[model samples]
Target: MSDLIFYTNPMSRGRVARWMLEEVGAPYETVVLDYGTTMKGPDYLAINPMGKVPAIVHNGRAVTEGAAIVAYLAEAFPEAGLAPTAAERANYYRWMFFAAGPLEAVTADKALGVAPTADQQRMVGYGSLDHVVDALEGAVKANPYIAGDRFTAADVFVGSHIAWGMQFGTLPQRDAFDAYVARIMGREAAARAREIDDALMPQPVS
Candidate 1:
């Protein structure tokens, strides 16, 4: 067994982690778990009490959450050049967390039809979905990549959100978003990740 073990369900946000793994070009074993069964079983629970997919155990240390996994792998395998340099650190961490926190929350709330009122908006981190969307738009429009000139692990996290958001209709189809997605998704690593996950997705019965 490799020192790195990846636990994921292809249909889940695990794809984000999978993409990062591909970018890192590391040899890791994949463990696919089914919902309500192996995913929630005590064995897996020990690894992640949240019973979530896309958890990684590298050198015997466990890391969970898609964004964290992306960041972790970048640092763990620095030769991949995915980790941000000193100059790119600010934008890298900023937009990465923005997508993980506000962008993810607002989109989920929107999908579930759970809109916050004006008074409640102040308490919510996202404030409003439009605000989050506009912020993301500006972030992508400001640079070729999220961190600046080069693609960082931040792109893996933020780009996954943008790509998935556009695909599922959670985010609007703006020209800037369209162009950004096209640019990042065109990466060879991104294509490899999609092919792997797409093959793993459940197929319909004949």
Candidate 2:
């Protein structure tokens, strides 16, 4: 039996974990959960009290949150080269937390039409949605990946956000962002993970 057990609903942020797992090349058993009853059921809740998808149990330890899971797997499978060295780890952690924090918060606020005013923006973590977006654009423009030239687990988390943002108009478009996403999408592991999740998506009634 594989040491890692992944509990996820393919339609959710579990997609990010799935992509990270594929990149790690670790053998894992997937326990798929349904949206309503299944995800809220006792068994899964025992695993994640928040009733969230994309939680993974590795060596009897449960890990939730997409960015954390991605980072965990990178360190667990050091051979994958998805984790950055000590010198570069700060940047890696910087963008990962940036994605999970300010960027996520601002984008969510924007989507819900609860945008912060100029004064509120200054007091907020992201400063403003535009500032967050511009910062990300400048980072990726400077290097092919979030941590630097080398691809790391940070990209899996941040790049996914960037990809979805660009696709859904949640983020502004830029040539550097476009090329960066194209490169991330080009990975065979990413392709496989997406194909698997696409198949998992619910189909129309016959």
Candidate 3:
């Protein structure tokens, strides 16, 4: 039996996990949850009580949250070489958590019609919108990728966030983001993931 089972809605954050699955070259079956239907179904809800997408089952265990899923897949498929080395552990965990924490906060705040004032933004952990962007800029500038010259599973998580932000206009498309995304999107695994998910988007109502 395949060791992985992935539940997702193509239109949601599932796309990010799909990218990570591809990065690790992990073999898995994808059960596409129907909107307003499968996600709320008892069978699906049991897998993720929050009714969220991008949840995975590996080795008979379930994992949720985009960052957690990415991290899990990296370790689960170590042969793929998608995780950071011992020396890069700090950066690996740092950027992965940042993507899930601060980035999520900014995206949620923007979505909830709660734009922060300059002062309020300063008091926030992310500091300011520009600060977040600048930090990302410097991280990529210092290394060929987020965790250094190597591409790790952290990139799959963090880079996916950058790619989505740039595409949706939520995050500014600066040169660093542009170059970093270009490098990530060029990966063979990422390309395969995009092709599969893109082709399966929004299946017809039956």
Candidate 4:
């Protein structure tokens, strides 16, 4: 058995971690857990108390959260060169957390029809979905990649959010976002990851 084990459901945010795993090109054992079943079972919940997919267990050490998983794999397998350089570290962390925190918060709020009133904007971390979207657009527009000129683990987390946002109508489609998605999602590793998840998706009953 591979020392690295990935627990995921193809339809979940686990796709982001899967992409990072492919980018690292490391061998990992995949355990597909269905929603509300194995995912919430005692055994899996022990690995991730939140009962979330996209967790990884490496050498018996469990790392949960999609963003952390991406970052962890990048460092764990340095040969892949996915970790940010010293120069790129600032933006690397900045954007990755931005997506995980504000961007994700606002998008989920929007999806659930929970828009905050203007007076409550300050109370919420993201303020508003439009505000988060504008900030994200500027970030991606400023750099070819999230960290800098080269792709890093940050892109796996941030880029996946952007792609998912656009596809699900959580984020507005703009030229900058479109171009940025084209640039990063075009990666061979991204394609491979998508193929893997796509194949795993439940087939429509004919």
Candidate 5:
């Protein structure tokens, strides 16, 4: 068996984890899942009952969810130096969860054309789009990256979302976001992942 096994669909958030795998320079086996067919297979469900993409089996343990997977990989392979010092732990954890929660919520809202009323804003953890965007702006603006100058896995989590948003025209084309993506995408690992996935997309179906 391979040292690592990754379950994913190119069209899903799994792309984020795929980028991270490349970041760590880890050799992994991939099982590409179709929309609804093979992902839910009994064997795959044993790894992730939710049938989610981006789930991984590493060294006999299962890790699921994009954020968790990124964190796990960073910790699992410390040689990559993708995590931060203990002093940076708070921001490290905060941004990862924030991306999965607030970032996802606000981006989804923008995509659906739904604006929250003032009262409704309080009910949501993100509060408002302006609040969420401003928070992201402050973090990246202060440092070249989210978790300070180091290109930690946290950037992979939040950066990928911002990159996707920009690519699809769902996010603003601010210079900060543009520069942030350019920095991350310029990494050799990120480029390798994109190349591999792009090649996979053009292969003939069996």
Candidate 6:
């Protein structure tokens, strides 16, 4: 029996988990869910009560959140070499959650044009989008990967955010982000993941 069951919607954040799965090089089944019905149904909600995409079940256990799934897959499939070393794990975790938390929230806020002001920033977790973007640029520019020279699950999580940020124009263009994304896009595994998800996505009505 297959131990890993991946549940996703091609148009959603599940794309991030899919890329990590490809990097893991593991066999898994994909269960596609819909936004209106299937995803909010009781069965799917059992896996993630939040009714969110990008949930994975492995060894009879379910994991939700794209970042969590990516991190879990790295440990679950150690042979993929996607897990960070002990010494580099701190940085790996720091930047990984940074993307999942601050980067994610700030970008959305920026896109919505409701970002918190400088004084209000302290109360919010992201502390403003500009600070978040500047910090991320520095991190990517200084290190080839979030954890160091090695491409760990951190890259899969954090890197995907950068890719989407740049593509959607939510984040400003930066030489560092561009170079980092170029390197990640060069991987065949990344290519395969993109192909699979793109194929599954529904065509726009317009």
Per-candidate TM equals 0.98, 0.96, 0.92, 0.98, 0.93, 0.96
Model 4 lowest lDDT segment of ten: 125-134
Candidate 5 local lDDT, 91-159, one digit each (tens): 889888888999899889989998989999998788987788888877779888787878899999999
lDDT for each residue of candidate 6 in 83-125, tens digit (9 for 90 to 100): 8898888999999999989999988988888867778998889
Name the TM-score of candidate 3: 0.92
Report how far off residue 144 is in candidate 5 (Å). 1.3
| Residue-by-residue lDDT tens digits, candidate 4, 1-206 | 77999999999999999999999998999999999799999999999999988899999999999889999999999999999999999999999999999999999998999989999999998998889999999999998999999999999999999999999999999999999999999899999999999999999999
What digit string (tens of lDDT, one per residue) describes model 3 on residues 29-114?
Answer: 99999878989889988989998798999988999999999998888888988877988888999988998988878866766777
| Full candidate order by lDDT, most accurate first | 4, 1, 6, 2, 5, 3
Worst lDDT run of 10 residues, candidate 5, spans 196-205
- Is candidate 2 or 3 superior in TM-score? 2
Give the Å error, residue 124, model 2. Answer: 3.1
Give me the overall lDDT of model 1: 0.94
- The window of 10 residues in a row where model 2 has the poorest summed lDDT is 107-116
Candidate 2: segments with Cα more than 4 A from true spot: none
**Which ranges of candidate 1 are over 4 A from the true structure?**
none
User: What are the runs in model 3 whose C-alpha is more than 4 Å off?
Assistant: 122-124, 203-206
| Order of quality (TM-score) | 1, 4, 6, 2, 5, 3
lDDT of 2 by residue, 159-199 (tens): 99999888777888899899999989889889999998999
Output the lDDT of residue 36, model 3: 87
Q: Which of the numbered candidates is closest to the native, going by highest lDDT?
A: 4
Model 1 superposed RMSD (Cα): 0.7
Worst 10 residues of 6 by lDDT: 109-118
